[model samples]
Target: MNQELDSAAGSLPHDNFRCGTVALAGRPNVGKSTLLNALIGFRLSITSPRPQTTRHRILGINTSEAGQIMYVDTPGLHRGAKRAMNRSLNRAARSAISDVDLVVQVIEAGRWTDEDEALYAALVEQSSPRLLVINKVDLNKDKTVMLPFVAELVAKHSYDEIHYVSALKGQGLQELEQAILQRLPVRPPVFGEDEVTDRSERFLAAEMVREQLMLRLDQELPYATTVEIEQFNDRPDGIAEIHAIIWVERAGQKAIVIGNGGAQLKAIGTGARRHMERMFERKVFLKLWVKVREGWVDDENMLKKFGYTD
Candidate 1:
């Protein structure tokens, strides 16, 4: 691995440089967001066990002495009856594949199914330069058993390379990162050397809240919930004030988010605030409010207003 890194390092130009985008594409809940966070060394994208937690194309920038890699984390693709929001999310995910220099197709280590094949087919049809990334390897009891199958699949699909990584455990990620950097097109860095992600602090705050909601809520409630940051204020004392609204599709869903006498909401707030403080490395005062936005998923105006539209 050191030799490989040395070879890649030698291949790169000597001057400060930036590379193009690398898109993370896969089915829902396959650890795409987690992998992006690992690659960038920060949580630029929100992650949960719930499918489709990532609804937008989030860019995570990694700057090093070698170059910069802008990782685009998109919503997971799924087959279903089309709703306005679903269509938008799918479109955003698919669109990332076309323009990016490299596409990282994340697949669950033990959960390969027909849907993954279909996604692979669609991805292949685009003729994009791609890599097969088998995620969640840490959860596998027999990693060697899956490698041959992954190798065959990669051969069949004609992918540029294959990487097995445990995103959550940070296993085998350095290889993945080196491979990504090697494959990226050489150019000047698109963002500042200090910038990690393109998303605004408000956007990340909202996503952190939504991630907590998804983790805490049960059943369909998690799927029906969305978070929006209404206001953010930075104080002089190294603290920030954040006000956000958690919108649910129905009144019952709203009640669940608020919890029995607001216990649940408090729990969500506490979890989200802690994460915010850790990410920002400062104090965060998060104000969360529950609102019922009926049919927000289907309502075009509501979806557009919340930055969910295409």
Candidate 2:
């Protein structure tokens, strides 16, 4: 086995091919997931209007002749350390940014919050090359202010480049891709040419369920919820069976998710199944059950069991 691996490694040739990991780091709701989906041409990371929607480091691979840019979409780094769950998310975000080829610091157009400033300040101290990106540019009414805003950003720390893009509208992504490709080191592609993400379908299924909860619930309930896939079976036929448990921190939360007579759970399940069917291009039977895991977020064992820790 050692001889065979050595032979394959010796024959490798990537003199000028560009390939490396790019970490998308930013504050909450800065559109990191949207930008990642736009660049990869697929929906790997779940997105919602809610802040801190992402809780893991999702890897999206963009393969092209220009080069392969493996983008790591991380959860937004925030100061919410009220619970062990929030600290787990923050640790995931920090770990994703380290040891990457480049860092894409996403920020909203014409807006800079305290969290953004704190994240940017930390990025400046890192050795990796960082690119300041102004996302949601199309939402800004005054286009002329972008230049000044970007200039002001440059004065803080010399970014490799500044990109203005609307991730939802698919504007200026080409330029961002070009900049990423230029900054990447010469190496062979890390993922297949046609591969979009490194995450499995089961993980995506769980995220989709959580997305549904975020979309349907209000206030702090969504944050108290997490999904666990208990059973996943691929039939010989063309259908997939999935059974998931929605973990809530309280019994009241479980009632909220279950609704008066399982109506809310059925609605969430229906939406999730439809979305999975469309994404997978096959039949998906999704089943969701709400359970009270009381104070799971603060328990390290429970957090690790649910795949929330690094």
Kindly report which residue pairs in candidate 1 clash with one another: 18-188, 18-189
Candidate 2 lDDT over 10-80, as tens digits, reads 34456677989999999999999999999999988899999999999999988776677899999899985
| Every candidate's lDDT | 0.84, 0.89
What digit string (tens of lDDT, one per residue) describes model 1 on residues 1-310? 2555455545555564548789999999999999999998987788887888899889898878788898999888888837888988888877888788888899988667776887787777775688889899888898688868776775667778888899999988999888888877667656666679867888889889988988888887887778899989998987899999998988888888887889999999999999999988899999999999888888878888888854
Provide TM-scores for the models. 0.90, 0.94
lDDT of 1 at 61: 87
TM-score of decoy 2: 0.94
Error of 1 at 267 (Å): 1.0
Q: Once superposed on the true structure, which residue ranges of model 2 sit more than 4 Å away at CA?
A: 1-15
